[model samples]
Target: MLLRNVLLLLLCLVAATPRSWADDGYRLWLKYDKLPNAAERQAYAQGMQFVAGSGATPVLRAASAELQRGLSGLLGQPVPVVAAAGSRTGGVVLRVDAQANAGGQPLKPEGYRIVKEKNNLVITGRTDRAVLYGAFALLRQVQTRQPLVGLNLSSNPRINFRLLNHWDNPNGTVERGYAGSSIWQWYELPERLDPRYTDYARANASIGINGVVVNNVNASARYLSAEYIGKVAAVAGVLRPYGQRVYLSVMWAAPKVIGGLNTADPLDPAVKQWWTAKSDELYKAIPDFGGFLVKANSEGEPGPQDYGRNHADGANMLAQSLGRHEGVVMWRAFVYKANSNGDRFKEAYEEFQPLDGKFDPKVLVQVKNGPIDFQAREPFHPLFGAMPRTPLVLEVQLTQEYLGFATHLVYLAPLIKECLEADTYAKGSGSTVAKIVDGSLDKHELSAIAGVANIGSDRNWTGHPVGQANWYAFGRLAWDHTLSADVIAQEWTKMTLTTEPAAVRTLVNLLDQSRSIYVRYTVPLGLHHIMGESIHYGPQPWLAKAGRPDWTAVYYHKADSIGLGFDRTKGGSNALALYRPEVQQEWGNAQTCPLSYLLWFHHLPWTQRLSTGRTLWNELATRYYTGADSVLWMQSQWAAAKPALDPALYADVAARLQTQRKEALWWRDACVLYFQTFAKQPIPAPFAPPTRSLADVKQLVQLYQLK
Candidate 1:
């Protein structure tokens, strides 16, 4: 009785101490930070004993450690790990059944099931990796401030494969990575495995992401070399316990570059043998290798088309080599040619819409969210339901390549939801992109979704602290698309920042309004692909020096004395014909078109009147001004809730908002000033003119290029 009283006294002391907890973001949403409420902490402390599996495995050890760490921080009590549970009522139990895994749903290698019994909780799976996933799921519940008792959750990934495509190259530099250098140190990798690799796996596993393609999609022949395969396998071993399978991006010209064969053609017998042998070698090293991601015949990459074959022949040859290995090929459909004749937007639909059923069952054609690359805002791809016989995977970019690097905060769940909710009208009215991706629309078994990763070696994983929300948002939406953006933001805010109602409302509004703000200041009214050449970092409204006409910035924005925007209706490129007539009818007429996407499909005159009493030019200028003004509102919203935020994090985010305000002004001033020359109009009353001349803004761009 004396010992029990002393323990209760200790718990009371620990509950009163708040500064002892660490603030480092390495823990992410799995922080398991202390519960502020006294009643909540006492309830969680009731079931605090640790129970282990029968055998000691690497994955089981990890599950035990994570639970210990989480419960210690959350319950304000250090729960001891034990080998068995003996009538310990209200205590946490980790039971593993090697025999009980026989009959259940067909599990993904990393899938797990967690159930609550009369006095215990069972975290089990067909394999040890599943146990590890269960541990993370339980931690998520604690972090999200949900009741842990009576928890009976069994979650398997809806998509068969959820992977991250890194644009890292053989050299240390990442193609568009804004966080820092590539995480993979190739020169030291086969031997000196960084401890950071384990932390990376933990972060990914916590979010339920199961696979990673570690190299650039633009293929490099060196990755196929035997020495580099050893390096890749080392990374795979670290991720294995966390249930993540490693995939590779293969060079289509491996036969010519690495194998020393004359041709890498799919029809050639020797080329076929080379790829088979190479795949066999990879499987020998890493038995559970996910599969290959091919970028054949896109951009400047070589493919089977060089030898008069199509994507079907190329994807099938690779899929045949992985026979019964439990893997599949992700053939990217981001193809466009150098031809100056046809519309570039209509090319991918024309090319792959004809070869739907010819692909192997193991092959999935990965299409982007839009017909083009990751633009700010775009209509849903017309190909979502164009091919009923083949399986398709939706590829969304989490990296913020087009949304403003890592600095600007744009919660992407809404953007993804916008695309998923769009009705394809392929079979009927209810056929949405979400149904097509989840395998409910076309009735195909294979279905998956991918996000281009934004992770790096930063202590927080992503560079900007708020950028972590994008990564978190992607995984949450990937698991369940029906979840609302507001709900996710509220959950993440409660777990990651503060649970104060004022702070939660402020953060949610900032996220909900963020994407529209970016679109307004950057690419308002559906104008697309006008970012600066190659780097695509900033604005360039006057670029006209690219090889193809469509490749230039001037093509999409046909600005002169008369009008602006690309005309893709029946008279112009006719790209609208790709969608069903129901979709076409809504977007076909310029006057009745949705205001969010009006400029994307039609070239309207500056003097033409809009639905509002204002002229087209006045509306354009107003949107730009309003976009800049919204940043001020965001700043004020954040400031109003500052007392509810941690001082360190509050200051960090405050500093970033200042930068955002300046950049927003830069965009508004530079774009409006340059376009004013063509429109032949004043800056309009009440709105001030640009501080600098148009020549000065052009010079600023020139100086950025020099750097």
Candidate 2:
């Protein structure tokens, strides 16, 4: 009886251990370890018999290894690595050359070509790194179950740099990280390199992200020291195999703090020499070192401005250090003064536009997607195409600082897509933000797009399981800004989990509607940052005081008995003048403006009637209710599709959806109750009265100070 019980116990233990089919989301979209269907296994087996590629560049070699590992696991067969193409064996050929091979059209350095030959397929590129990217692309199609027959695709990156900026400190704590601790085990790095470094590289490579900023933009001078350089080199070495280069966010005062210089002025010859020497030393440690990222003269950080120099002076000085290294400097334009005299929204444009044509060719001005910080919703930044002569890189935040953090399932692709698709009209009618960013509008040679990373040391990478989708979506959009959010969501859903057509449809609809739903409940119809003061987690529409005037919630909502919303029209900030006349015309009028953006553009009276036939207060109340109500629908949809998913994973998301639903109602109740004081009106019929008094809500907000 003891022997029989022991055997049964062993079987139970084995069964309970997590499997690839279960909810351990460590695999992300590269879930090749999961068992595959018989037909897929056979097709992949026949198509990936062996891998052939060019000279052994680390990038190319890594690509070959990844293909073999992914193919062997998915198809349950060993895939041989070959040096050159041989008699067609229904395998793949990876070609890396300066010129196209086999009569194929030539590819750009960052471009790739994938063509299906009789029984074989050729993945070719103009360079070894390009071939690496092409390999990942080919594998992605297979992982998503796309038909491989008659494959003839040629692709290139629209942006020159697709990068992730990590706001992590040297102490291993992430500044705005909602996920656990920082991913970089900084204290043990350069010697105790973790295997997770390679895993990080693999995840990034699969999605076409090629660069990483290793520290916070609020930088510490220590990263520039010799010790940190060695540590950075170690991280770079792991990333090198995956075709990724590591960039550092430098403290502008590094010359004084690290190099023993008296002053760190951009125009100072000694300071310039110190930086040049530092750059040389960095390249020696890591040959493929991406250039520096700088945030100066903003929020008390030191910069060229401290020495009475402008942004161009600071950027140009750093650009000089990277001379002939094929490196580029990204200068952040998120500057605003400590004083309250000027409008905060116009600060970045005011600072950068005049410096146009003054920056070095290798220096790209990095602008946020919105004029303000990454609020749930705001007008597009005026700087997108305002400075035609400058090379600008659009910076977006994947971290949910103003949204609900890791708690809310906000699919940010639509938000990203909204900013990219907005018409800038810099050159003419068709000069959309996409064209401006992709370099087509101004013909700028250097273009880039970046997202502030939300990654951390959580077991699943991102804290929330679904937060992984935002990272995946950013890379897909970065690779090709024109890809629709719906298409990307569907592809990710199919590749990362069950490929049941019905379940895919449900997932796509959920993701497609998610961002707008979040906005509706949290800060609907152009309502900007009203989250709780410091942590920025939940709603605090009544918050009226902060150190700075613009930092308070009431400053943005501008709620009065007459109306709600920020007025940036002709009579107010006149920010509309920054856009083309057509844009202004569309947004300048409350009667004609889109309802989704009505509050963002106009401060209409509460009694004004909207197209929906509801008064402004009534409409606002309805939107908050409807938006929160959608969370229930999302929960139901996810539940209905649960049978097709891993039980553990399904239950995890199901619980999160429950939390989201509860919080959504909290946001609705709190915002409506608070705003009612200004509107001086009763709660509309059917919407319940406030569960707590206004003073009780204030006490509830005070409890959030622990964060």
Candidate 3:
């Protein structure tokens, strides 16, 4: 009886105990733990005596509360919030400009400036939303231990609309999400507002993302119903104060499915009226409704093409419906057919190029970063420069659908930077994809960029703790494309992982090298779309049959006895001609082309000697071997920085790194052995061959598919 009583006492004590600050990754990069260094704390605390601001609105209240919470935690003392900073020095003041252009140089609607004025830090902006952003920036500087005495910084977003396209469903499942179940509990949403929603909005606003599309592209008609609109309004209410506007992905045939219409023809009078009425209802419930993102006529989704109308017809119809409201239409350009004859790479370009000037003023054509689906590495899409008259939204995937998902530590800033910095050569050498998307190249007022979100219902927000860096990087780059991937990585590492100098440098280097290492093992030398079927995980080079020919790996790689690679040159599909004359000149020849893109444009022989001074066969084998081995190097780097990282966070990543290494080997063996069928060559020198046979690897992959 005494033992039972003691056990009950122990259980009660455990339940009552609060978790350690470093025990979970729930805080993300917003961690405001007290500084370990007394000197550093004193320096930051010197300028943060009090947080002076008015809780005039939800946004202002959020900013003030965030500052108080952050400063109190960092300074190890309560930082009180006051209505004003009159006669007070060493305090932070929030100031909003009644006139946007009243300041000497006018600030953008969402721009912020932090300066040292009269011995106090002043965060001034044209709007309350800007002040909120300024608050987060100040916290960032303090968290990174940056000096604040002489601080003067001003920043604005490069694109007009920076949005996260969440492929979440109403049924609590995320389409391509690697993290757990959906964060939005549709069943409990209208009545029970989860506090997580507020945190989600805070994180987004902190990084300058102003919009969120909270549904899948393969949308359902039910979301357009009156009942669902109320649920959406509730979510929008929480996000509105943080400068976030919610968007919905509308099914093209929603009028037919839910509004008792005979057809969803864009030109039909009744269909047009139905959409207009729906738009009015949406705006009535949520006045700040951002827009609609539509996926039509892609992958068997219903579109206006079914009724003998083009993309412009469909987009213009939606644009007309939203014209009465302050909303825009994002018409997707990711449409393709299975019968494209293994040339899906050219489909989007061919379809959208001619309709460039026909789109309505309220329509922004949303184009994926590449012509193909979100592969690890792809040449910049041909449509970027081709559509000179249309405002195109650059859509990038943060979900790692084609990368290693949440399991691998592949930093994606480099991948995004590669596309952003690519020279389209449309208006000469300096014409970059960034310029086109930012509206500077084409001189279009409407501009936008989107990142398919990697967020879900996991405790850490993202499955892998470090995966948060991708989310952070996307927001930063959307605000300013010129920010280097290296700088962003270092900042995220310090803010989210550790602030120690040595550890920060080590983790930064690890992040910088991770994407390339992943590329090498999975799809080196311009290889594309060879991942496993359906799941898009692991290696499946031997996959020959699927529902469509284009869906098969064999259709893309085109491996034969004499050579490997799909020939997109003049001798083959002639897809290279889609680019500008300059791009064609640069990538036209296999001899002068960068090896990174060699196989993309040309099919070379197995024994072909190249600029690297090795046969194609040997070089391919070397990359596969070295890439798999480099995971060991990454593991070593992580272990060396063990002392600086949180124990739980460190252990979590270490276990994931182990899994990555094993998977790397799996990729190497599977690709090397499968391609060896054509090469008929032994594994290159100084690298040991796989212990398992080709059959063994195939059997293992089959088993993985079952799991």
| Best by the TM-score measure | 3
Worst 10 residues of 3 by lDDT: 10-19
Structure candidate 2, residue pairs in collision = none
lDDT of 3: 0.90
Candidate achieving higher TM-score, 2 or 3: 3
Q: List TM-score per model, in order.
A: 0.93, 0.95, 0.96
Q: What number of clashing residue pairs does each candidate have, in the order they appear?
A: 1, 0, 0
Candidate 1 lDDT: 0.81
* TM-score ranking, best first: 3, 2, 1
Error of 2 at 102 (Å): 11
Q: Tens digit of lDDT per residue, candidate 3, span 1-707?
A: 67755654454344334446565888888877777777988888888888887687788888998888788777766566889999999989998985544247788888889998888898888889989999999999988888886799888778999999999999999999999988999999799999999999989988899999999999998899999999999999999999999999999999989999999999999999999999999999999999899999999999999999999999999999996799999999999974666588889988899998999999999999988899999999999999999999999999999889998989999999999999999899999999999999999999999999999999999898888999999999999999999999988888888899999999999999999999999999889999989999999999999988888898888899998888999998888999999989889999887888888888999999988899999999999999989999999999989999889899999999999999999999999999998999988898888988889888887887895
Better of 1 and 3 by lDDT: 3
> Cα-based RMSD of the predictions, in order?
3.6, 4.6, 4.9
